[model samples]
Target: MAELQMLLEEEIPAGRSALLDSFTNLERVAEYCESNYVQSPDKHRALEETKNYTTQSLASVAYLINTLANNVLQMLDIQASHTSLLLFL
Candidate 1:
């Protein structure tokens, strides 16, 4: 459990940074594509859809991470209280 927690703590920030970097690169490419590669209305619409999908995916991941962290904390709190109650008894 300690190892798993430690790994999550260590990796999450790195993962977030990587995700940010990727998103930045993606935006730059998308902008360039819209300005240069997207010559048709259909292509422009496709690019917009891609951008929206990626944004939604990232938001979902962030929400899930927040939910997971809260659940883990709640579980730990419950366990600690149980332990204390047992000790008192």
Candidate 2:
């Protein structure tokens, strides 16, 4: 039980860090697109690339959120089961 608790503690923070990193990347991409829009010789290509990167970043953030939610749910389930066992004992 302690080990499971430790794992959840570690995983939840890692998931959050990953989510933060994805958001940072998305912001950086947007900044880059805006900064280069006036200077980019190939505007269409740059826009396409930015769109693709933004899409991927959004997907990554979504997946991380789902993972973190699942982790929390699993932790809650474990605690509930432990409580039930204690009550029965």
Q: lDDT: which candidate is best?
A: 2
Tens-digit lDDT string for candidate 1 (1-89): 55446535754555566566766766766676566545656876777776786687678667656755665565577667778999999
TM-score per candidate, in order? 0.47, 0.83
Alpha-carbon runs more than 4 Å astray in model 2: none
lDDT per prediction?
0.64, 0.82
Best of the candidates, TM-score: 2
Model 1: runs farther than 4 Å from truth?
1-41
How much is the lDDT of residue 84 in candidate 1? 93
Q: Clashes per prediction?
A: 0, 0
